[model samples]
Target chain A: MLRSLLEFSGINPLRLRMSWVSASEGKKFADVITEITKELQEIGPQQSYIREAV
Target chain B: MNVQKLKEEAARALGRKDVKYLIGYKKGSYGFRVSPAFIEPKEDIDQLIMSPLCNMSLVKYVMMEETLPGLTEQALKPSKIAIVARGCDSRAINLLIEEKGVPRDRLYIIGVSCQGVIDQRKIEARFPQVTEPAEVTEENGNYIITVQGQSHTVPKEELLAELCTVCRYPTPLIYDKLIGDKLAARPFHYDEIAAFEALPLEERLAYWQQQFSKCVRCYACRNVCPRWYSTICSLDSLSPQWLRRSADTSENFMFQIIRTFHLAGRCIGCGECERVCPMNLPLMKLNRKLEKDAKELFNYESGKDPKAKSLLTTFHTEDPQGFIL
Candidate 1:
């Protein structure tokens, strides 16, 4: 719902991602983080939505 | 449509031992203004009034009522309060109960089926400053606006509020006592939002950036919302300062986004936030977009059932997770 709302507000919905992993699934969590990093790099720097150019 | 029934109901509610006061509309001192009347025991119900000019939602004032800690409905000094409710206002009460902001038994809802309301701004713009009290009556899709010795007829469609045009619920869903006929709900669509969505993302961003830049950060939108019942808002909190006091485009964007997200499934479309905003920001468009999304994605319509599970907190086993990384 938040994702959709952000998208509607003209913010890229891809910037917000939700992932669920069990306590023991450390590898799965790391992989998810790596995947998000690659996606974020492709999406470029968010300008209008964020506070500063991080 | 019966003013007498509304007065009788208000008098009855005020006569109750537990009810502190009945909040109804009364004639304003000047033109096109309708004030929220708080009727007490000694006060006559003749002061109570209702019209298409009564555009402000009394639900926000109800939520603003003092609710001290450990003050249960049964134990409080003013155990119950009554208010004149329209279709949207009734939904606001339901949303409050669903979030535990207020108890059900503590409110006496006198329901009135609304045939939409005239936007105060629209009327003001059309008939600028007449200083004197103006009378408006609805008849045959026309508003007979009487100012001074002159009378002018205006089409209701031109003066009707934007939120009212798409209102599905014309009758109160829950009411302790009803005062008018129950009207059937209207089917609504998001033609404007759909058209906006069809535009390129860059144009959409530019549109919003311009709107956000105009915001003065007055917090009128936050203060007027029926669902913004937080005692200490995150914007004011030091621990996790959501947005700065600055009124720049970025900060305004943050403030609005946070607020919009907070009201995801709870906003009942009273459109009070947009109504009260001094900047004339298109806040309802943002709100309605979320409403449309919530309906399409979760198959949820808020304020329909107070006892139903919340949309954001509850997850179905078969819930769609296409966005999960």
Candidate 2:
């Protein structure tokens, strides 16, 4: 719902990501962060939702 | 519809020696307002009235009394509280009981079969200048609103609340003495949600940003929520403030997200949060989105079955895990 709300407000929801990272899964955690970074890069900056007046 | 019978039931409940008081609706001081009335004595039952305008959830008051400070178990004798419950209010009561927020034994529920409630905002907008108290009665799908000794009849659809229009449960799911005949449950409809879901991500984000930007963060939505029974809300923690006092869009978004997430499987869809909202934010859309997703993803509906545990609390191996990755 939050993601949808953000998306509705014209923000790039891909900028936010959630993943299950276990204590011992160091490699998996690194892979998740790398994937999210790539995704955010592709989405570019969040605009429109953030008003200029504010 | 039968005011006499309703008053009679309230009188009987209030007459009970063990009943602390009866919480119901009464005529407001001014036009079209239905205030929650606390009936302690049998004589006070006469003041109780049930109408299309009695849309306020009484379950919040029950939760309030349960958490009231200085009311230790030994301080006051344990007594049952008789409450006039509509469909949503009963569900809230059941949810509270299931969550162990309130004891089931401490309530005497008098259920009223609702035919949808009128939106006060809509009514006030229609009749903007009525300062004196007005009486509105429903008849043959029309609201006969009398203001200043002049009667004007309006179609029910013109004033019916959006939530009520799509309400599935019109009769109380749990009640000791049901007053009116049970109403047939409406079929589920998610057209609004589907339309929103079909929108492109950017547009969706833009729409919510605009709505959320106007939020004043009054916390009325949290305060009116029957399930928000916690003594200290997570949003109000001083050690780590989840939400800042600044009413900026980003912080407001965070506040809304946190609040809605807390009610993921617990919101009863009473629409009180949206009704109490001063800014008239479409809070129900966010809540109903969760409701829709919870139903589709987990095959769960909150406050429907009293026997079932909350969705987040209980888990099965076969539960949908598509989002886990």
Candidate 3:
């Protein structure tokens, strides 16, 4: 279902990844998001669900 | 209708060499109340009876009973206890076995083809002061109740439990001995959930928020729910703290959300949580809505198959995903 959601958003499959987060792992979640954001930027702005700033 | 046949089957099961005590319903201390009966001997099976008043789901005993006191190491093997299960109770039993909470070999079920049980609240509202034990017998579409030597006949619809009124399965799904034939299936509908869905999002959120704000962190809902029985309740863990100890609104909302989501595709719509609620919150509404959504979106019904994986645990590649946003 998560993959389906990502696919529907027109996100590139190779750039996105999944990670598990425990309640005590705030830093881990933050770090994963940071890495994912950088990777997304490296992949450049592809035409996707988000058209503009909300 | 076949009360005697049920008792006989229970007796036969109890008399089996490998069988332990059979669990059924007995009279409660007050009116319209039923208590769990643990029948051991064949003679004791005579106490086993089924009626509209016998609404307590016997499936809970599968997971609720404490291990026998000071048993020898050899005696620690799982006991094969028999259960007399109604439609909803049978589903719960199957859920327990599916989740591996109870071993399949440890259960012997005498499935009763239920004609729907009565709601104690409705009965009490109609016939109060049944201080002594009462009898509920079915006769020609009506339940005849006798208390303190006075008899009253009420139409079944008037006292039918809220869950039973909307029940789809009147027959037990699994059993060792079938006591009676199945009833005609009712038209399955989720009108209550539809009504709730028709509400505006703000109103719906507000409605739940208001109800959840009243929660006292009593844990009665979790304690009474057959599915919520894990070695440790998710709410109790300190590392994650899914729910905080304080009874404030923010924590209460989180608690209710997590609890309800955990039961998303698993609740049998037993109405136990609603009945056990001291504050009379409509907990079943939230549960029934989830049950409805599961049916509509995933075409999934919990406890129908012992081998089937849970809805949330196994996701389909083509599952509806656009609604998540």
Clash pairs detected, candidate 3: none
Error of 1 at B311 (Å): 1.6
Give the Å shift of residue B217 in candidate 2. Answer: 1.2
Q: For this target, which candidate reaches the highest lDDT against the unseen true structure?
A: 1
Model 2: runs farther than 4 Å from truth?
A: A1-13, A16-24, A48-54
* CA error at residue B23 for candidate 1, angstroms: 0.5
Candidate 2 local Cα displacement, residue B3, angstroms: 1.3
Q: What global local distance difference test value does model 2 have? A: 0.84
Give the alpha carbon lDDT tens digit for every residue of B1-325 in model 2.
7789988888888777878888999989988888999878745567888889887999999888878788877654547999999998888988898899888889999999999999999999999978888888899999999999999999999999999988989999999889889888788777898888788875677777788889999899999999898887778887787667788888788888888888888998999999999999999888888888788878888888778898889889998665555
Best of the two (1, 2) by DockQ: 1
Using all chains and alpha carbons, the TM-scores for the candidates as numbered come to 0.94, 0.94, 0.82
The CAPRI-style docking tier of model 2 reads acceptable
**Candidate 1 lDDT by residue in tens digits, B210-277:** 99999999999998898887888897887777677878899998889888888888788999999889
Writing each residue's lDDT as its tens digit, candidate 3 over B230-275 gives 7677789998866568786667766766777778789988888888
Return the number of clashes found in candidate 3: 0
Model 2 TM-score is 0.94
